[model samples]
Target: MPRRDSPGPESWETLFTGISHLVTPAPGPQRGPAMRELTVVEDAALLVQGGLVAWVGPRRDAPRTPSTRDLGGVAVVPGLVDPHTHAVWAGDRLADFEARLAGVPYEEMLARGGGIRSTVRATAAAPMEELVQLARPRLEALARSGATTVEVKSGYGLDFEAEVRMLRAVRELQSLLSVTLLPTLLIHVPPETGRAAYVQAVCAELIPQVAGEGLAVAVDVFCEREAFTVGETRAILSAARGHDLGVKLHADQFHALGGVELACDLGALSVDHLEASGPAQIVALAASETVATVLPGVTLHLGLPAAPARALIDAGACVAVGTDLNPGSSPLFNAGLALALAVRLNGLTPAEALTAGTVNAAAALGLRDRGALAAGQRADFLALHSPDWRDLVYTLGASPVRDVFVGGERISL
Candidate 1:
């Protein structure tokens, strides 16, 4: 590797060759303008220049480069894009996990001001620097596990001050790690404040401030029976879109409250946690650009039924996978494990699951340029120590990754 004062096309050097398999892009039905077809070359090679992909093709046709690093017989896939997560918060909820396993229902826990409320309390109490310190390791760990892009939400901090604190922490991590982060302000089902007041605060105060500062890339709302009603959900999301922020919804997790339909109607970037979403919603999503993001870990962790991932994919709906990494429901953060669970438990094919974690996930985050190994796409990808690409999910609990890269730079452990 060499360093230059201002690296340009002339500084382009280094080639990665001898790859056993390369899943360049995961194909979807009729690649739309916002979507692209990823190409996989067998025994492939990639040429990188100035931290960007220069060329990629079969090893035999690999263009000559000044320098090269040959990784013998390894599978190289695009680095994962985890489109949904709630990774920035304080305190552990391991005790809540034990209580849930002991037969306490999740609804009961939330009614007692436990679940999300507990996390909100903890997050509000922690200092910004402390939150940053705690969250840095988790983001780094995701990078080490082959996730190059992840979305961080700000729901734990329900109020303006606390919410901005979480967003600031999310921004700080971006400057410190190799992982690219998409920050979303999750106005998680308001506080004890009245509906109208909460609406006023979010629509009139918080959303504007967040957008004005360019702090959040998207806005999210939890739309369940226990959370905001369809009417309230509409108010929040509509106001968010008014500010030119992309919309996302936490819909159909515990019940089907028409959140999925609402998400499709608004053309949300993605709608997450569809444990109760049905065929009509799936069809609507298939016909729309809104990505159907499924969280199998939440269902698995909560002892609930996983979303119908197979049906959605079968209907030509663009699907994405994510760790709804939160305190009460899903504490699991490993993207590889999430993909494996999606394959066996959520009824998705290995190829479909891979797409969910990669390109589709990137779309869910409103990122148009990343999530594939194309000439113009970012040079972020992963090197797996497996002979076959399918083995990554076929062997559910195993970690076969050897190295992770972002912008053509190998992530340091």
Candidate 2:
């Protein structure tokens, strides 16, 4: 292979070559058998201009450019997109972990104030700068593990002021990190007392303030038995839609509470944590545009049943994977490991797992920009350490990503 001095990071146009294989999914969210489809180009070259992909094809047919970089014959794939995560928080859940390990059910821990409520109390006391400082390393760890885009939810701060502070912390982290951060205002759990007042505050005060400040692009509700009821979720999500913010739900993780049907009816961007989804829920998801996002890391950490990913996909639903990175239920930091576990737990093929972590995941976040390595997409991709892209999912306890690029510029890992 021929090599040339790499262009400066600020170069206007650059062509990248020497890829052993370039694997990517088709444009848009894939469903059914299409989810298994991947385009593999041998000896591929990518042309990036102004931080967007200009062309991608065989190197022999690649248009010549003034600046070029050879990736040294490594496999390349679209950078992983983590669409569902609770990545911003203040404290650890070590005690909660121990209790769960001792056979105390997760709901039992939450009811006794050892789960999300525990984190909420700690996070509410932390300053915004402290929150940012604490979350920086976790986001960097995700970046190093092949995640170029991560969705961060502010759920630990359950009250109005605390929640807004949490969103601001996420904004601060965004400026200090290389990965793209999408903030969400998550309504985690209702207060022990004054549940009605809290829901009213979220709809009449928190949603409006967060939307007006441009702090969050989406609003999420935890609709389950131990969280907000289905009726309360409807009101909160309706307020978000009125404010032009997208909606998502943490549903069916422990029991089917009609959250999936409500999400579909509301036209939510995605419904996540479907560990308890049944045939009826799968049917509803398959018929709706809402992406079904499965969090394998949660299953791995909590010892829960895997979400019905195979059934959803077979029924033509768009399926995606996420880390659900959080202190309580899931402490996973690696996006690559999420994909690997999805294959073993969720019955997704390596190709489907890659698509789930990329294009479909992007769709779940309502982003059409950076999931595929094709013209008009952002030049965000990964150069794998191995020649085969499947190694990313096949390898256990290791990351196959050797280098990561965002907006056509290489980022230090």
Candidate 3:
């Protein structure tokens, strides 16, 4: 009989041994205490073949393979899954950041055309090639920081032509980068015209066009005081679903709106931005199937109240963390540092943060293949410089990642 957890009939193609610790976050959907119950295997090894994890166990029983690598006691963990980001946009918002730093309120900055609108104008004017060029470096940095998958949004381009251009740019970026891009059509802020008219356009025109052409897999909305109302958001999401697109929402970021209820009611895949959510919303989200994807980068950068991650977890919600990479609020792409912020500001332990950024985030993205090291999962992972995995969070500013592999292919940064 084959030894337990040993490589089987499928010959291992790539063997990695001498790992001090291997963080799998395995047996998917570990909730509450289980999330903290890390699946750390010491003196472990992982075997891969055909771009999937074949077996993970002790090196003594590991099968022979054509390619084998020894890590020399370095730690290994699942590659990060950044479930929410505005990844493709043109222009900079340094002015807005500086203004916010100088006592200018966020709303005031938006009104003065220094926030997302500035990027909206610039992205609309830019060609698709320019958008791709701008996002290439930022995306490369995230790959270097150990992110195997990223969810990109199109919100800066509110109009039909601009939205198409933005999504097309993301299309090009997918081919250019090693990281897997999950594109989302985000209904950012309402258009400059009347909110009613803008909602009509999105519902009747944009969603159908995007979904019909298979341009995006999901549709997202910003439901806030500065964005659409709950009723408007409902219409937009409904139309998206009718077009057979999944739904997500930016809810309760600035107010205690009914957006959370709407998202849960519609069975949206994930509800992001919970800075303004309260105990009731937390309980509701915990009971729902939807994911609570908190963006610590946004809260830390904007000086807003951190999302109640502890409450969400205590209530048994499936919580995931993201960098919310964008030009205005959170100009971030490093998922390693984002995980550190999740630990520091969101009240999660290092193990919990690792689980959040990997397995839980993959669920938020509706991707079941690449977040963990197990049989049939994609061979995406990172080798860290330190033997202890906590160094990824402890050393906040530094990237502890030494090597990144996606689909058994090493990414050279």
Candidate 4:
């Protein structure tokens, strides 16, 4: 099969044997693990055509094809999915990091207009092309680190024109990069707009405009103590649903103020930043389809309490992991290292951590065919130079990814 790069299916093509190990992100739990499954095949081979896997089995039992490219003994895994991110923004937060290291708190920094507002002012003042150029290197870095799919949000641009500009930049990046971009309209919290009117504007004006024009696929709200209130979040999300946009939430990052419960109640695709989430919210998430996206990079960067990942996973919640890559919070984009941090800081198993970044993350973003290696899934994956999968997490802060392929097309980094 000829490998395809986009999300949807197309004409068929085929790939012949040369796979050392095929690590399918299949669900491993009996009660349905966060993702579907991970089927491991040693000395395996894959048949790729039309950007999809037509057949996968041991190399000895591989089917013949017209175009077969030998990959030697490289270990293969599905393309990583980063479901939660604030990767597109202006300005830098290195000073905030230094302050935090000097015993300053994130809440304290926010109170002094050093956190999100810093980025807000810089982003609003920046030209859209400049923002795209600044953001392009970040996406290229992530793609080199083996992330094939990622979500970009527009929280820094709080006004209508700026918001449209950010979304348009995202579309431009989509055309420019090999990675798939999932744009989100983040109804940010500005100092000017009051709670009621801001909510009305986002729901009544921004959501409809964004959804109607197909500029964004999802709507996000930061439902926290310093951000939008629970009621305001609900209104924004409700209007987004009416506009047929998927919903996600920046829930319980700094406080447990019913944001997780609200996300579950409104059927959000995922709830991120459960750093301050309570037991009730964990239970609610475990009983729902909404994925719990843990951002270990944010915890590491801000020096805050890590999310209660062990509790959520043990309670049967679908857990995904991401680099909350942004200027103010998590500014890095190495998903493999992020997975390593997830395992060490949050008590996740290596296998579970890998699944969090791959399959569960795809499910979190409402994507179906790109997170795993199966008969019909996309031929998007990475060829790791390491023999052991744990080596990826073991050698943190390093690049073990030797090659990357999206839809059977080799990406030359």
TM-score of each: 0.93, 0.96, 0.95, 0.93
Report the CA-based lDDT of candidate 4 relative to the real structure.
0.81
Task: Give the alpha-carbon lDDT of every model.
Answer: 0.81, 0.92, 0.86, 0.81
List ranges where model 2 is wrong by over 4 Å. 1-11, 105-113
Instruction: State the lDDT of candidate 3 residue by residue for 1-413, as single tens digits.
Output: 10112323444487999899898787455566767877788889898887788899877778877778888899999989899988788889988878878999877987898888899999999999999989888888888888889898999987889998888888889877777888899999887777798899889999898988778999999999888999999999999999989999999998979999888999998999899999889988988988899899988888899999988988888889999999877888799999899888999988889889998898887777878888889988989999998888888667899888887667777
- Stretches of candidate 3 exceeding 4 Å from the true structure: 1-12
Better of 3 and 4 by lDDT: 3
Error of 2 at 324 (Å): 0.1
The lDDT, on a scale of 0 to 1, for candidate 3 is 0.86
Model 2 lDDT per residue over 1-413, tens place: 10112334544798999899999998789987899999999999999998889999999999988889999999999999999888888878998888877989767987887888889999999999999889888898999899999999998987789999999999988887777999999999888899999899899999999999999999999999989999999999999999999999999999999999999999999999999999999999999999999999989998899999999999999999999999987899999999999999999999999999999999999999888999999898999999999999998877789989888878886
Give the per-residue Cα lDDT of candidate 1 at 168. 92
- Relative to the true structure, candidate 4 reaches a TM of 0.93
Error of 2 at 401 (Å): 0.4
Error of 1 at 207 (Å): 0.4
Better of 2 and 3 by TM-score: 2
Lowest-lDDT window of 10 residues in candidate 4? 27-36
Model 1, 78-130: lDDT tens digits are 88888888989998777677778788877787787677788899999998999
lDDT of 4 by residue, 29-85 (tens): 111354434578988888888777778889888877676777777778888888877
What are the RMSDs of all candidates, in order?
A: 3.2, 3.1, 4.7, 3.0
